[model samples]
Target: MFRYFLNRLGQGVIVLLVLFTITFFLVHALPAGPFQTEKAIPEHIKERMEAYYGLDKPLGVQYVKRLGTLGTADLGASLRLEGRDVSEIISQAFPVSLQLGLVAMGLAICIGIPLGVVAAWKKNTILDYSAMALAMIGICIPAFVIGPVLADRFGQQWQALPAMGWSPLSPSYWLLPAFTLGLVSAAYLSRLTRAGMLETLNQDFVRTARAKGVPEGQILVRHCLRGGLIPAVAYIGPAFAGIISGSLVIESVFAIPGLGTHFVKAIEFGDEPVLTGIGLLFGILIILANIGTDILGAWLNPRLRSSR
Candidate 1:
């Protein structure tokens, strides 16, 4: 297990290195510098600015220099937000994003799993059909659309919750945005869980459990559910990675201040520092989440444990 973890960590480091290299050149390759929009800055001043940001250095030299900073946790200042370090900005914003993502994932799991379980247990009955129909609708409707509709119906018309803006640890702020971010995930999770459950129920072990006179509830919970849950657990890492990165449209529509909003703005303004900071942060999150899931799965399943 320790070796497996170390291997995953090493892979994560390599992936981050690749991302850093690509991002460095890609940003530089853009037709303009951070100060390019300022047509008024004279040639000498522009040259000085480029030199100050190490833009004057060769691509390989800049890459090497930046790699040194990365090694020491120095992500540098935002080109757009002068005097502000990229890490500082991320620190302030990440908690809000993390909170939103957690709320969304919580909602997804709470609703999706039970719905899926009921659907599978009920088979082709009304409960199954209704649950599947709901899942289909959730999959069809985009987060952006859902955000406004929820805001309008639940916030504007009903005044049930705050329609926009993040409030630190505020329950009111959690309702709309969390639901919007979670709805699609819930749909997918439900479908996956139902499929996995159905497949596991038909397996020989489940049949053997029944033949051995195991209680139906115990068989379902201890055996069928455990096997069925694996697929949902597998999907959870990426689903969470998506939520943590923020659904750009949902963040925008709902006016949630998060990494997603920051990323889009950074892209629009061509703010390389902020963009790269967020991109690297999100990439790290994805890699970590997957590794964590793998480790957890390995621990849970004897097959994986033995194979490893």
Candidate 2:
């Protein structure tokens, strides 16, 4: 188990390096200069601005310099935002994205796992059909549409919750955004979990447990569940990649100040530092999520646990 974890961790590091390298070059390759706008600035002004931000340096020198800063965990200065560092902006914004993602995934897990269990337990029944129907609806609907509809029903018409804006003190602010993100994730999880649980429940171990006179609940939760939930757990890593991408739309709709919002703005302005920083930050998160998923899968499967 320990050896497997170390292997995963090593692979994660390699993935991060590749991600960072790609982000660096891609951002630099944009056609629009970071300091340029619709109206052209004076040549001298542009040169001074470029030099000020060290854009005057050769690409190799700039990459090496940025790489050095990255080694020290500095994300360099934001070319689009005056007197701001990408690291500073992200430090302020990421907590909001993190909170939103966690709540969204929590909702997915809570709703998806049980719904899947019951659906698998009573396969092909009305309950199974209904649950899958809802899951399909969720998967079909885009978050952009859902956010507005939810805001209207709950915030505008019903007056039960705030429509937009965010505050750590208010759980109400998180609901629409979190739900918008979670609903799609829940749909995927339900499908995956149901499939995994259905397979595990029919396996030899489950049959042996039943033959041993194990209580149905005990067999379902203790023996089969660990194996069943592995897919759901593995899904979390990719699910978060979706969740964060979804948050891009959700953040704009709900006026949430998060890394997603910055991410969108960075692209619009071609803010290299901000774009690279947020990209790598997201890359790190997804990498870590995947590593965690691998570790969890190993824990649930003895065959994996015994392997390096």
Candidate 3:
């Protein structure tokens, strides 16, 4: 296990390096620097700002310096955020993103697993058809579309939920956004769970348990459901990373002051330092999520454990 963890950590480091290199070149290649905007600054002030942020250095030199900072756990500073340290900005923002993502994941698991289980147990019935249909809608309509519709119907017309804006740790603020995100994700997970559960139910162990006079409910829960969860768990990692990264679009739509919104604004304004910081943070998130998925997979599957 230690060896496996070390190997994954090493690979994550390599992935981070590649991301940094790509982000550096991409930011530098933009037509305008961070100082350039619709309203131009005085030439002297722009020059001094460039020099202070190392934007005046050759791209290669700036790349090396920025890369070196990562070794010492330094994320530099955000030019767009008025001299706030890059790490500080990320630290402040990560928790909000994390909270949103976690809430969505929890909701997805709660709703998706049960929907799937019920659908599988009642295959070919109304319940199964309804669950599958709902899942299809989820897959077809993304959260971006659902968010506005939900706000309009639930918030605007009904005036039950808040229309927009984040209120930080307030359930009222997070409830709509989190549900919008989770519901869309859960739709796909529900289908996957239903399929996996159906397959597991057909397996010989399930049959043997039934033959041995195991209670139907006990067989379904102890044997079929547990086995089925393996596949759903496999998807959780990538789904989680996607939610975190994709939150940018949702946050923009909802006017939430999360990392997603901050990152989006930075990109739009060509804020190199802020954009790079956000990119690096997102890249690390993806890598770590993938690593965590691998570890969890090995733990859940004895075959994987033995092979490793």
Candidate 4:
């Protein structure tokens, strides 16, 4: 297990390195510098700004210099936000994004799993159809559309929640955004879970358990559930990472101050440090989530454990 973990970690590091390399090259290759929009500024001032940012150096030199700061607190100053260090900005913003992501993931799991279970248990019934129908609607609707609809219904029309802005102290700020972020995930999970459960329930072991007079509840909970949940478990890690990265849209809708807001802005302004910092941070999250899921999968399946 220890050796497997180390191997996964090494692979994760390589993935991050590749992600950063691609991001670095793409951003650097953009036609204009951060100061390019300042048309009224003197040529000497632009030259000085370029030199100050080490943009005057050869691409190779700049790449080497930037590589030296990987995994460190020094992410350089923000081109868009003067006097602000990129690392500091990330530290402040990421927690909010992480919190939102976690909540959204929780909602997805809590809602999706039960819907799936019921759909599977009642396979051909009205209840099953209803649950699956709901899941389909959720899957069809995008988060951007859902966000506004939720805000309009729950916030503006109903006056039950805040329409925009974020506050760590108030759970109200989280509701609309969390739901919008989670809805589609919940929909996907529901279908995955139902499929897994149906497959597991059809297995010979389930029949054997039933023949031995194992209680239906016991079979469902202990035997079926364990096997039934495999696909859902595997989907969870990448799903959570998707939820986090996908928050960029929700953040814009809710006006929540998180990494997503800065992420979009970084591209608009060519803020390299912020973009790279966020890229690496999100890469770490995605990599760690996948590793954790692999560990969980190993624990669940003897085949996976032995293979690892």
lDDT for each of the candidates?
0.85, 0.87, 0.83, 0.90
True lDDT of residue 189, candidate 1:
92
Error of 1 at 100 (Å): 0.5
Against the correct fold, how does model 4 do in TM-score?
Answer: 0.95
* Residue lDDT tens for model 1, 235-261: 889889998875666778778887777
Model 2 error, position 237 (Å): 2.9
Give candidate 1 misplaced runs (Cα > 4 Å): 211-215
Superposed Cα deviation of residue 277, candidate 1 (Å): 1.4
Q: What does candidate 4's lDDT look like per residue over 70-176, in tens digits?
A: 75657788998989999899989999998999999999999999899889989999988999999999999999999999898999998999999999889999988
lDDT string for model 2 (127-148, tens) is: 9999899999999999899999
Question: With candidate 4 superimposed using the best TM-score fit, by how many Å does residue 253's alpha carbon deviate from the native?
Answer: 0.9
Candidate 3 regions with alpha-carbon error over 4 angstroms: none
Candidate 4 segments exceeding 4 Å error: 71-73
lDDT of model 4 at residue 240? 98
Measured by TM-score, the strongest candidate is 4
Which parts of model 2 are misplaced by more than 4 Å?
Answer: 208-215
Q: List the residue pairs that clash in candidate 1.
A: none
Better of 1 and 3 by lDDT: 1
The lDDT leader among the candidates is 4
TM-score, prediction 1: 0.92
What TM-score would every model get versus the actual structure?
A: 0.92, 0.92, 0.94, 0.95
Query: Rank by lDDT, descending?
Result: 4, 2, 1, 3
